[model samples]
Target: MIAIGIGLHNFAEGLAIGNSAAKGEISLAVLLVIGFGLHNATEGFGIVAPLAAENVRPSWSSLVLLGLIGGGPTFVGTLVGQHLVNDALSIAFLGLAAGSILYVIIELLAVARRAAMKVVTTWMLLLGLLLGFATNAVVTAAGV
Candidate 1:
């Protein structure tokens, strides 16, 4: 389920990359790819962390399938988004992605609360917001 949510989010990100490429903003597209690559690296760990916590050793094939489920939509979205190139369409996809990720975050927060990590959750939330802002700042500074 977490992979599905992340996949949806990645799809939106793919759309952004594709739209940029479609508009001939190759630099922006490249930057997006680099940024997303870095972002997704961390996400892979997030995807597996719960399983690791529970001592669930997923098979290699299962891990591969999960990877595909989480990342494959980006390719599809890129293909679709390349041809669309409309602001409204991009916004709609992003909105959907946001909703999906919010659901995941809410679920995770519930689990954290159950584990008595309220303070930690608050700090992590703050750190996440800061990281987001920092990433945005870097992207913006790149003149995109």
Candidate 2:
């Protein structure tokens, strides 16, 4: 489920990348890829969190499939945007991503609550937000 949700979220990121590249915004496109690549690194952990928690090692084939599902959209979006960039399409993709992320966040929060480490979990959530922002700051500093 997390994989699915994050994959959807990544679709939005890809849309941004695609649109930028299509418009000849090379710098912006490169920045988006760099920023999004980092974001996706963390998302990989999120995608496999449940498996990790259970001490289950995912098979190579499974990992491949997951990677394709989560990252393939970037390639597809890039192609589409290169040929036909539009605001409405971008908005719709982002809306879908937002919905998926919201659902995943709720589910993860429930899991944290069930673990009964409310204070620690809350702090971790805040820390994650901080880390995400820090990453964004780096990209912003790069003139994005």
Candidate 3:
């Protein structure tokens, strides 16, 4: 359920990127996609981390569903973004995304703490943020 929610949220972000690009906001679109793709790579790891820690392999159906939840949004968002690009709407969407992602991070941290893995959780969170920023920087540098 959480995975599906996260995936749908991600898809909405993708929509923003696609919408911007469709409107000829190429630079913004490219930057958004690059940043989103970078963040998503970490998200993939997040999805499997708990299972991996438990030494349990996710079933094929589960993996497929996870992938759909995680990736289906990119296509949908692209289509939506192509059709809409209002600055206020984009800002609102971003705020919503940030809030949801932050909640997920907090939940992950709580889980890690309960498992007595505080250090690893802290580092991973930091690394995720750094990677996100780094990717955004590169995209910005490229004038995208």
Candidate 4:
């Protein structure tokens, strides 16, 4: 479920990338790829963090399955967005992604609360937000 939510977010990102490319903004497309690639690296860990917390050693196949579930949509969405450049559709996808990702965050927060690690979770959440802001600053500074 978490993977699905993240996948939806990545799909929206992919649409942005593809739309830039389709519009002949190759540089913007590349920039988006670089920025989103960095973001996706962390997202992969996020998709697996719950299993790590549970001390569950997922099988290699399961890891691959999760990767596909979480990352494959980017590729699929890129294909679709490249062929179909519709602002309304892109906006709809972004909205869905935001809602789904929010759901995932809420669910994870509940798990953290259940684990009685509110302090650690709160600090980690703050750190993540700071890092995300830093990343955005860098990407924005790069003129993306």
- What TM-score do all the candidates reach, one by one? 0.79, 0.73, 0.82, 0.77
Q: For each of the candidates, give the backbone clash count.
A: 0, 0, 5, 0
Q: How far out, in Å, is residue 64 in model 3? A: 1.1
| TM-score, cand. 3 | 0.82
Tens digits of lDDT, candidate 4, 74-96: 99878877887777765675566
lDDT string, candidate 3, 1-144, tens digits:
457656766867776777677668788778777777777776766677667767899999998888788778778877876777787777766776677677666656665776898788778779877987887788778776
As a whole number from 0 to 100, the lDDT of residue 132 in candidate 1 is 68
lDDT (tens digit, per residue) of candidate 2 on 87-124: 77756755765687687678667766766779987897
* Segments of candidate 1 deviating more than 4 angstroms: 24-35
> What ranking of all candidate models by TM-score puts the best one first?
3, 1, 4, 2
lDDT of each: 0.78, 0.72, 0.73, 0.78
Error of 3 at 60 (Å): 1.5
Candidate 1 per-residue lDDT, tens place, 5-38, comes to 8888888878877887887978778777776776
Candidate 4 Cα misplacement greater than 4 A, ranges: 24-35, 52-55
